[model samples]
Target: MDARFLGITELTEVPSVAVVIDVMRAYTVAAWAFGRGAEKIVLAESLDEVRALKAVHPDWVALKDGPPAEGFDAVNSPGLLRSADLGGRTVVQKTTAGTVGALAVKDASLVLCAGFVVAEATARVLRRRECDAVTFVVTGEDGRAEEDLACAQYIARRAAGEEVDAADHLRRAMESRAASELTEGVREGAHPDDVALCVELDRFPFAMVAAPDDSLMVLRPYAVPR
Candidate 1:
């Protein structure tokens, strides 16, 4: 199926496979960690619980979700991942929107984590699988952001086997006239670092999928690490 973009509230009504984007930090960092050789990423709804998991797996790496204002690691900065030496560790991640979407879409036929950094890879995966119906669940700022829309459209077009005209998508996706306008939203409470990270067309080959349990699900594309 062709991939489409849906707002979080619209997710419950959509029947297509969901590719959730918490790009500002959640999915972006998850993608970065996986790309950097992290074995897996455990997405948690609660920061305290993430820390608890870290306590048990002390050797595993951990990062908390702190937005730009809070001065915490609420969103994993791309620069941080790019500069760190992750090697083969597993990263335990918690975010306001990314993990929350993971928990919310626990029942989707196939729940995949995506971001601009991994958009091309994600599109390739979807096309290879030939999913009958696909949708992008964009976890926006309080559930709103143009970055999510742009990424989703990029994937959606790819899934449809349509040629991607970056310029066209940017013109339509942004609120203002130019691609530069999209970045302006970042200053209005959106994470500027995240905004920058999400705009990176394609930077990773790894994908993050939900590993379902009962109440919550974790975002890790590969097998869960011990």
Candidate 2:
């Protein structure tokens, strides 16, 4: 199997399987949500879609830019979700990087969302599936966030049957500009705890897979083979 790592902007060619990595927040939060019993997470490319989904399904938690809407449960912060009661609830997530990158791969045979939390599980699944070709989409904030790039490289290395030192990757990611912003509270709506959680590699034993369910793209957890 051949694996290629590319940033979100270089997604001109879609592979048989695409793993979208967003370690700074997005996919890390999604993994936490799933671990906390979230029924499913719908990936929205735009804030407008998130609002529309919330309007139709008032019970769903919507995460958009800036503060969360009135009566909404939370924003796009993994730290906030840590205390949330997402039991049997659906979450609608719209982020600038992760979800956008996931939506861009229109031709991928399978779409998987990844972060440090689900890195091992994602790699195991990819190896199990044995796809002829796989692409790692590092959905960095703007151009190429260091955290996302590190997480993507970790997964790529694991999928290629290499021993990965997750701690080293996490250390590098924690020192990145994106991590600095989140930790120092420079980025609005970002929490330091979110960055802490994002860098905890292999926190979960399942990978989030974006599968088509009717008209929506639902993120469901796939348990990694032991």
lDDT (tens digit, per residue) of candidate 1 on 133-167: 88778777544566667777787787677888776
Which pairs clash inside model 2?
none
What TM-score would every model get versus the actual structure? 0.78, 0.94
What is the C-alpha local distance difference test score of each model?
Answer: 0.65, 0.82
Cα lDDT of model 2 by residue, 11-79, tens digit: 776677999988878898898898888989998867778888889999998865446567456777788
**Cα lDDT of model 2 overall?**
0.82
Error of model 2, residue 136, in angstroms: 0.6
Q: In candidate 1, residue 130 scores what lDDT?
A: 78
Off by over 4 Å in 2: none
| Candidate 1 Cα errors over 4 Å, as ranges | 2-4, 13-16, 67-75, 168-195, 213-216, 221-226
